[model samples]
Target: MWSAPTTTAALLTHVVRGAEEAGYNGLMVALTRNADASAQLNELSEEWTSVHDVTGQLIAVLSPDPEVRTAKIRYPIVYECAAMHDLRLVPPEDHDFGFNRCFVGSVHGDQLRGRAEAVPPRPPQEHRNAWTEAASRCASYFGITEAQIPAVLLLSFAERTAVLIRLRPRSADSLYDLCKQVAADLGWTKRAAELSARQRALRQRQHHLHRVVDRPELSRAKWRSRSADRLGSRMTDELRAQYDGLDRHLSSIAEVNPALVQQWRARLAELRSHGTVEETYRQLFAIRRHVIAPQDRQKWRRLAAKVGKVIAATDRVILGRYTQFWNLDDADPITAELRRQEAEMGRQGAEMDRTATEARQELRQIDDELNSVAAELGDIKPKHDSEPGLAAATEAAARHMLGQIDTDTVDGSAGLAGYTVRVVRPMAEAPVEHIDNSLSGTVFGPMVQAGHIAGGVHIHQHGLWARMRRWFS
Candidate 1:
């Protein structure tokens, strides 16, 4: 089972079989030898030539196994070449293969070939110093500290070379230009540009905020007159025309006294000065007390009150009618309504609590009576307890009967009458005298019989009462 190939032909056969088993279609042999060793080269060449044809034919054959049949078929040829020197030569202490030896393998058409070369040895100290110097230079150029040079050296040779190439200076105008290029490659340039733009925008916003804050008029105009002041200015001419028409109407009224007319004109002038209806109302109320003559003060007060009502109504129309300009107090209609509802709910909740307390008291009395009856009945042990086997058999029979009841209930295989017949037939044969004396045996026996009758009347009703009785017992 485990024999090494001893001859060239056996080795070649083994290699061919292995290649076939591994699903490989080709093989390459690269053995280092002296140029004078022609015999070994001829033997290997002959062995390959003999097996090459058969190997190709075997690889081309379609396998019956689905896994093998679906695989891509390859007609591979072997390349037997001898190296001119001993490429395997290395110090006896060095066992690492790829580190000391380099090999190049390639596949062409249906053929595979390879070449191996030994890496010449260098003094250990010199080798390490050269690598350290290269890593330090790369790390320094890339702005990495000297401490990170070891990590840089730990990378593969190709990766280390890539780092060196990246750090190498390109043709640029100056060091700053080179630094810009490096920053761009590292993506720092884009981030710095973004930060600079954000800083400029932030400064611009701060300047604008300072200018607004420094001027009180500007701040008030910006914040306070957002809507009404702007719209009011646009509608001022139209509103003035309407007021003028109203004044003309008042002038034409025959019943209006001249002094009252003059007073109303003064009010209109005050309205124009105030520039808002609410402010005009406030000023009118303040002036009303001192301005009117004592003889006409009562009538003028009534007229001023009516004018205030009209101004309030107009204000509601100009601003949104539904808008609540001030917070509601306890006297507000909505607040009054909410309080009334809360009081009604409190009264209803108290009534419900009283009713629930009465119900719980009644339930407690009923539970006490039931629990007393249960404790008295529980004191009487079953007579079959002295015979363990008989007691167990009785319990098993009860469980079986209950299981049958559950099955019948779930399957709906029998109506109430059928269930009653099945239950009563078994129970009628059992002795009612076995019931404890603590229970009224005569009453309980009849009640059990009545329950069977009720089961025939309605299975759901009987089941509900049965479960409740079981839980209480």
Candidate 2:
């Protein structure tokens, strides 16, 4: 379509009629810049610019560019064609109409360019012949026909002459073939060089995309930095208004769930002998009553059930009487024995309380003596403030060992005997001690002979401390 502003109404009629004959669902009739129909179709052109419409089919258009008016505008048009054919224009965003539509333009280059200079005459037939030969040479170098050149070439020519010669490549497959031939003609003779290079560049881009997609650690760190944007800073906003409204609806409840913060704080404080978990759960449930509706007291009920199961399991593991403990249905003699034991425990507890008081006094008296004896020897058991970090470094070294289980770290060290595990906190009073035992034909021979050791007895722990000290030093 070409535009003389005076002829746009007639051109639009022709375009609309042609599109109807071609069975298009809709047509986008475009015009040159400053043309009479520009204002009439601005909304329509904007609508056609987006690829997807309501029905998930590609709406047909010249291209996203407002000036497209020819069949050779193939980059956007061909992609849109593929989408229309495949019905892949799913409405993935808002403001979508339907997916199947078309556009026609009636615009000349002068009007599009917003100029009134006299159009330069076309080159004579001699120039056309020479250019054709040059195009053929370029095409032959790339082992492609002249028709396979990309549409950008025509757009370049249009800019120079205001004469848009349509350029329609046969297909993407053909264009790819031409690119390969071009690379070969340009002396990239290696196998699939151009395609491989492009693929490598694309792969690098995709890898960067994958890194971004997989970066949860970085996301959490960024969230920490931007935490000032959190709810506390925006308590007067619409979001807060909605939150308040929701809170009003839930205000009649007697209690919400027991706060996890309080529970963890209690756990941190009470580091008594193991099996304290059951005691914690029991104390939590004793605060709740069964009279409340299940919906209101569901959390307490769940805690009670979980604690009961744990207690039942512990009894089964240690006493080998899971059913009797859970059902409260032991045999008569067993029941009698339990009752007797309970009574005896009550009496012994009182006696033990008195004994504990006296024992504390005695321990105070001998504390200095005990300290002197302990000072005479090296530390019996090392302590670590960050126990879990020490444990993790041990794990990392163990993993390293597995990779080198059949290989040595350096020199000719073999088996687990050559490694010694050690942990050093970032800033702390002392490092965790995992002494090696080189004498027992095992990794920790010396440590075992001098004294029994607990914590950090992994195979990779052999002699690692010496190596770590060497590295640190």
Considering every candidate listed, which one attains the maximal TM-score? 1
RMSD of each: 50.4, 43.1
Which residue ranges in model 2 land beyond 4 Å of their true spot? Answer: 1-184, 189-196, 199-205, 217-225, 229-473
Candidate 2's error at 353, in angstroms? Answer: 52
What local lDDT score does residue 446 receive in model 2, on the 0 to 100 scale?
Answer: 37
Residue-by-residue lDDT tens digits, candidate 1, 88-162: 222121245432222211112111211111221233233223232233333332333432222211011111111
For candidate 2, the per-residue lDDT at 11 reads: 25
Candidate 1: TM-score?
0.16
